[model samples]
Target: MKFLRPALLGLLSLAYPPLVYLGLGHFEPRWMALPLAGMAVVRAVATRERVWLAAAVGALALAASSMLGNHALPLKLYPVLVNTVLLAVFATSLAYPPSVIERLARLREPELPASGVTYTRRVTQVWCGFFVLNGGIALFTAIGASDETWALYNGLISYVLMGVLFAVEWVVRQQVRARHVHG
Candidate 1:
């Protein structure tokens, strides 16, 4: 189930933009919005977290507005919503102690040196910057671009960019670790 959860999420994320493009033109956005809103509500109720609660309310409002209206513009905010949430998560981690990347690094190298701690902090900042840039691009595409363009950027381009960032970071981390091991 642990693997299943991430797999399902990945599949759903990949399918979302194209589905939005198809549904918005020919079908109602409510078909997608309502279920997502319901899931948000369920998650909010289960977790009782402020973020989830806020998301639930926002989703419900979006679903209602989309259903009541003929235009699918409200539905087009999907990328903005997702990007904002991710940005918040990454940015907020930087504010609190042990940035998310540092926490992950500590799991692998429990005896992390001072240099490693500094490296992780810098990496975490880089990730926050990436999320900010990506989210800005997503918001811009969502608000002003055609659905096809939005789909291309959010679904394909963004993922490719993230892959590149992850690959680069992994390579750098390996070099840094080797330096620590030899130096």
Candidate 2:
């Protein structure tokens, strides 16, 4: 029960591209922006995380700009904003200490070995690189591609890429663990 709301919100964000594609056919861009802004606000209030708060501000700004200009461009930029925020957060963790991947690894193994720390840092760097490439594609799709293309790439292709990355990382992690155990 405690996790349900956040989970649903996450699903909503995942569904955004297709929703925007469908909504643009029948509704104004300003109308479409409302749900995103509302969700961001709810997430910010619920989590009290700086990332969510920044997202809320960005969403609100998009809504305002869309309303004022009657343009869909702002709505299409949400994915870019999300990727930017994630990249910043992950990159910041790398610069400070205990990279984002290390933090998640800590949840499972509190006393992570030095090798595990190094592996997690590398993984975090990989994720940062992924974000940069993904965000670049997203920006191009948002600015230059048709609505269908944007929806297809952002809604389906991006998730598939992420899943593949996760699967590959898991496989590598298993190999690393096996070597650690035997070596």
Instruction: Give the top-scoring candidate (TM-score).
Output: 2
User: How close to the true structure is residue 118 of candidate 2, measured as C-alpha lDDT?
Assistant: 99
Error of 1 at 161 (Å): 0.7
Model 1 bad stretches (over 4 Å): 1-7, 45-49
Give the number of colliding residue pairs in candidate 2.
0
Clashes counted in candidate 1 amount to 0
Residue-by-residue lDDT tens digits, candidate 2, 1-183: 889878988999999999999999999887888887787777777777777788878988987898888899999998998899899999999999989999999999999999999999999999999999999999999999999999999999999999999999999999999999899
| Clash totals, every prediction | 0, 0
In candidate 2, stretches whose alpha carbon ends up further than 4 angstroms from where it belongs are: none
